[model samples]
Target: MRLSTLVYMHKNMEKMEPLLYDVIVVGGGISGLSAAARLKQFHVKSLVIEAASIMGGRMRTHQETNLELGAQWIHGGVNANSLYNYAIQKGVLNKENKIQEDSEKGIFFYTSTGRMIDLETSQKAWEIHERIVDESENYPKGGNGVQISLKSYYEKQAKEKLKELRQVAKNKTFSGEYESDLDYDEEDLKLAMDALIIQFEAYCGDTLDEAGVAVYGTSQELPGGDVPFPSGTSSVIRELEKEIDERVMNTKVTRIEWKDDSYFISTEERPEAYRAKHVILTVPLGVLQKKSITIEPPLGVAKETAIANLRPGRISKVFLHFNEPFWIPGEGDIIFLWTKKEMEQGVKSKDWTTRVSSIHELESCPNWMVMWVSGDAAVIVDSIDDEQVLKGATRILRRFTGDPGISVPDKILRHPWLADPLTLGTWSYPSIHSKHQDYYELMRAMPSPENPRLLLAGEHVHPQYWSFMHGARLSGLEQADKIIKYMGKMKPKQNGISAAK
Candidate 1:
């Protein structure tokens, strides 16, 4: 609906039933649902309001494509992962559709010139990957010897590696074991750098020039490996839906007027407000940063400042389904990169196809290959139409595979989370300048002059699992626990009675 229509409803809608509750959880995403489920565990009265007709938030899957359009992976399958454990315990994971580990799959790396990097060179490429991860934790010191952009640090090191290769006339270990002759030009550096940046896009949602060099693996990976869901993440949503008795769908929370331990929740659909003694906001950090929902008696400076200071990630995916797979078979996933010339020509041609992060062959489904898009190219993706996206994608695929007879994909699917009204972006990431204190500020809600009337929860603010589904889920449990302890300090407000002084 248009903004004007929302404003009109805000001005003229009749007072619907004044839905009063002990607690109201805004957002039906995992965070909110988890909070509501935990609250139910304590036998605390609670209701959930979801803006979308369905729940699961970013965990949605495309029905036709069967592609997980959001929250596509479980980084940690068991132990340390509550959500995955829940899926296992409840048998929510589809047994017919087994999860596949992305790392264990085969991967092929191709240059812009349509030449696949040999296995030996691919091993070197992995060595580069490890070097960059190390850089994420600790960047190489310049003359001044401090941290710099991955781009700058990487280029400098690449230049040095080239000099050493030329000096020795062959690729060799520093200990003097000969490996192979370095047969590369300046273009190889560009290709590797660009591909690495694209890979970071999937994780950090920022360009290499801007991403904090050492922030990549700074957060703990849940061990094991990430697995894609063939049945989609909706199973988790369906499970949460069963637990939530009061599910308010399609209610866009516009303004929340909080005062004296009570919340008057307003929505675009109704001028009438839902009153609650406490409110839990499980909205994504992007939505909160957008200030999509106004909180009357505005949040405290710390909360506002934290919201402004923290960074929200942006990413999108392109899924191309075909009659057959002409791509090479790897044990795991495939990494495709454009040659410097190919990358340049595509940009000059205004085709963003060269921007794909990775072309992942779905092991469970052979007819499809998913391409991840991120960084500046992702921004450009929003402006182009679908036909061009498919055309550009196929053109690049044929060029890399050297298969002129390869036909166009039978269908195309793209996930533009950046343009999503509800999400506004993907997960959150700590930029080069981010601090933990800001996250703390975002987590702790403003005291209502009398009681803690509001709480915030999402993957971004998670202590251990930031930017992951498990982190978001655990955050809700933590927030619910916080509220439970908070409410323990005072008696529950009886219905139709004001708890305010």
Candidate 2:
């Protein structure tokens, strides 16, 4: 029978043959897969139901360039990440080809006027950034201070400490930090403001004005810097696939009805409901906020409130392929620190991506130029007409490079995570109204009266590590351990025969 037909047909589940599973994991993304992978170690039977035919969710690789459309890097040092450890143990990653960026690559910088800023100017920027981050770390609750955006806080602080910041940049020597300095000058404040705002827009997936001061740098950075995989993030996805026992692809779940200590999961692909002892609900926060999956009796107040309160980061990436390198050559660092002229024009277009954050000329692929955009700008690029997008992209590229001879890219690739209904956004971020404990509230779920059985695990739920892939991975393993421990306390059925087997 076709999936659509099965979805509409309401048959008597009692008459149908029961498809039972020990643990049924929904949404076979990194979180769900990691949960199942850990279950394998316990010799626990598991089934993964994925809506998409392909297993990897946000970790998609672009076909033409082989660049990651979603997660591009391991975001970890040599051996600290367990996900990387899994890939290495499974012979997925090539150790010799690992990539990391540093000042050794000779970082490049440019201004709205296409003029390069002195290293001192960029250093001042980093110092200002440190001040903002320090403030965020110190103030976990935004309500403690007069409620305001990170942008406002930055402006107020930058104005007060402008002279001190200038002196620090000129006098203090940062050994090898490549962060573009926050320039403070009557002549150069535009350069600094544009740079600062773009970083917030790209990183937070919202205007700097909307992002909360408390959650500015709340997401914990792992020990090691980012580890970009030339081979793509799929290698790690493939390595983890071996651990799954059974999986159903193209199965879109509509509802999860729990009654009498068992779950009845309905999907678009199957007529009969799938029975499971416990479920690992690992869908993205956006999906939950939309109520994509209808829970029988509804979740707790804390969890439900969190689903409504937290904001999902809607971001996009645009890859432009050129015939050749058009910018200045031999500059090892692929970064271009230039903001567009329209930004200084004192007009804010609905098209927020007027200033592209970083234009990268990757070492592995020199012919391709990559750019990252977040928030409304990314949405503008995705939703606008192709001609408009081309015109905007061309203007930004030409203005920054100071090369009017630069022609349009031969091909363009876009990572439209927001457009994807399943994902809905790039990641989760704390909005201005958020409480620090909101993530923990979302993480806590109950299978029954006071038991932590129907657990929630995802990067969005991890307070310290919410936006990172490593956080999602760690949350999955954590949930799996909870289930394992829960199961150990209960004896096996008298028959010792699962309904599926």
Best candidate (score: lDDT): 1
Give candidate 2's error at residue 6 in angstroms. 16
**Lowest summed lDDT over 10 consecutive residues: which window, candidate 2?**
177-186
Q: What lDDT score goes with residue 149 in model 1? A: 62
**lDDT tens digits, residue span 391-498, model 2:** 676776676657788788777777567777788888888777777678777666574424555777777887777877877887888777777767773335568752
lDDT by residue for model 1 (354-398), tens: 667677777656788777777557767756778878887787777
Local distance difference test values of all predictions, in order: 0.70, 0.69
- Candidate 1 least-lDDT 10 residues: 138-147
TM-score of 1: 0.83
Clashing pairs in 2: 122-181, 125-181, 125-182
Give residue 335's error in model 1 in angstroms. Answer: 3.2
Q: All predictions: root-mean-square deviation over Cα?
A: 6.7, 6.5
